[model samples]
Target: MIRTLIGALGGLVVALLILGVLATFGVWDSIGRVASILGGLVLGMVFGQLGIFIAVWRE
Candidate 1:
């Protein structure tokens, strides 16, 4: 549980970093695209946590 929570926090930090880079480069400059990217980031984090939990459980 603690590992999953930490993973989530790390994912959020990574999302913010990616968003910062996009804004800095003037890339993907649309509300819908930004939303989509954010959605994907969240989804990726969820799947990543699931995978982590599975791995830890199997160990």
Candidate 2:
């Protein structure tokens, strides 16, 4: 149970770190696509992992 929580939090932190790096480098300044894609990808990964955790816990 704790491992699952750590995994989820770690995933979220990593995702935010990626976003921060991109924003810091001004990579999304001229393009909106990258920001949107990154946001969706990170969020999807976080939620996906959450679902997996819940399923495993239930079993």
Candidate 3:
């Protein structure tokens, strides 16, 4: 459980780091700043729920 928590936190840190670097380099900015954030949030939520659904189904 602890390892899972650590891995998840590490993954989140890496994801944020990549996003920050991309935004800093003007990559995400070119995609429309606010739109990128909104899209990321929506996609993240959808994918997260999909994972949960699959996990439940497999049980």
Number of clashing residue pairs in every model?
0, 0, 0
**Best-to-worst lDDT order:** 1, 2, 3
Q: In candidate 1, what are the lDDT values of residues 1-59, reduced to their tens digit?
A: 67786888888788788777877787754846996879797888878898888788888
Cα error of candidate 3 at position 4, Å: 0.6
- Stretch of 10 with least lDDT, candidate 3: 1-10
Supply candidate 2's per-residue lDDT for 44: 82
The TM-scores of all predictions, comma-separated, are: 0.56, 0.66, 0.49
Q: Write the per-residue lDDT of candidate 2 for residues 3-27, one digit (tens) a residue.
A: 8778878877887787778778888
Clashing pairs in model 3, backbone N/Cα/C closer than 3 A: none
Cα deviation at 12, candidate 3, in Å, is 0.6
Q: Top lDDT: which candidate number?
A: 1
Q: How far is candidate 2 from the true structure (C-alpha RMSD, Å)?
A: 2.0
Q: What's the true lDDT of residue 56 in model 1?
A: 81
lDDT of 3 by residue, 1-59 (tens): 34444554565666667666777878854647655675586567556656665676677
Which lDDT value does model 1 have at 46?
76
Q: Score each candidate by Cα lDDT.
A: 0.79, 0.78, 0.62
